[model samples]
Target: MTKPANTQLTDARRGDARADRTTFLWTAAFIFAGMTVTILSAATELQRANSAFPVGKVVLYEITGFLSFLAMFPLIAWLVTRSTPGQHSWRQVIPVHLAASLGVVILHVSLFVLLRKALVPVFFGEPYFFTDNLARDFIYEYRKSVLAYGIVLFAITFGRELEQKRRELAAAREDAKKSHRLTLKCGGRSIFVDASDVIWAKSASNYVEVKTPGAEHLARATLASIERQLGDAGANAVRVHRSWIVNADYISRIEPTGEGDLKIEMKDGATVPGSRRYRGNLNLS
Candidate 1:
């Protein structure tokens, strides 16, 4: 038999792609907004603490802060996508996070120093000023860099959890819409089969024997219940007798018996009994 169309599968892939794009854009926007907020807040604090602070230096400091996250957030995105968050223990994540934190701190400081050296010469007409105490400078900034890295990881984890929940909820609703289904016992397991695959059905005392092209399976429901449950799926199936229903699509021939009962021969060479009482239901072309 031919498999069903994959339109839903294609659409699901498209939806996933769209959702990923939206999440990525939102993450980038948050990082840029966060950097802008940090710059403004730093400028405010510096102005209050030192009224005579050089405006150019304060602007340079805040610009470096912006560039820092500009470099770090992409790395966070790559890390989040590559790793399963909760699968790693603190021992694994902490070391990786420490290494990343150090890398971003070094990049931030290096960019700031280089940019200041070039810009200060052109605009301030002097070399950028800094203390010779490199260790002290790095130690102070590394603390803040480590904290920011933790926050970045937290954001990625939270976003992933939200996306996973949304997918589960959507799948639940989709499952609810699938009503044309039957549960059958086959090979010692209860399997859900589409009613469309059933070529015939017969009664078996509080159960239904469902016949497909290649196999007969047992269903836990009564014949009447199975019939009603498969109502939407039985455009080709018709009740030919109180004991049997036949899929018209597989009807090879019908013949009248000398005993007045009708016989249904299926494409698979199986013959099913048909009562005269429901003979009108079998007006097949």
Candidate 2:
């Protein structure tokens, strides 16, 4: 039974949504793991140096910083998707990314400072100050933020490319599976013919005359177009002339004409003309 067009479309949308959710979760996991390791390393270094900052306070500061960066990830992902690397010229992509990175740096620093100011005094007795010099702190944070932007951009870009490749491979496999069946549309009617059942085909004006064991179909398609539709089955179905394509599996005999052309007889008792120009393309064992 054939499925309704709306149901097929809905299923496709659901599949896309599931794939997107999976990609998002994987990306978040990688970012979280990296931030966790960084936080641990920072705490360890501070303890080893005997810094006056409490270890718990340091951990809290790092957590807030990580959250700020995480919050910026959606914006970064949007920018990357809008101006993909290979899709756009470097001149165009570079300026967009640069501007976005600056915006991200400013937003990230502001968020991180706000989170610290709001949480630090509640945890500890003293209020938190990001730095003594505002200008210097902003510049320092910008340097690190830009690096983070680059990393996030690369991750999203690579993930999209990988997903695209996976989809292409999957589509190719599905096409291969469907190649064994040809759908022929005539007027308001549709016919499905197995590739192996096809004995021969010939060009008829704009249409292709496809012959099967006990049926003939005049599909509104060109010979070349119908030939491509055969896909993997094309190996057995060869173009013996400009207007003719014959199935070697159904060929009973190939007789050469005195005029350098050939007469190919099918097991279905049909005959197709073969041009010597395309004779090399046909091989019968």
Best by TM-score: 2
The whole-model C-alpha lDDT of candidate 1 against the native structure comes to 0.69
Q: Write the per-residue lDDT of candidate 2 for residues 1-285, one digit (tens) a residue.
A: 445999866755555445555666776687679778987888889979998878788678778888898888778877876787887899999999999999999999999999999998999978988898999989998998798788778777777665654554444334535666676667746677788788888999988899988889998767875676665544378999999998888888999996769999989888889998998887744
Provide the overall lDDT of each model, using Cα atoms, as 2-decimal numbers: 0.69, 0.79
TM-score for each predicted model, relative to the true structure: 0.49, 0.57
For residue 151, model 1's alpha carbon misses the true position, in angstroms, by 0.2
lDDT string for model 1 (1-285, tens) is 322469656654455445555555665677678767876777788878986756676666666666655566667656655553586776777777677668877887787777777777776677887558989988887787667667666766666656654654344334323645565544546566667778888988877888876677886556765666566444377899898887788898999985657989988788999888888888844
- Which runs of model 1 end up more than 4 angstroms from their true locations? 1-51, 82-84, 179-285
Give me the displacement of residue 212 in model 2, in angstroms: 24
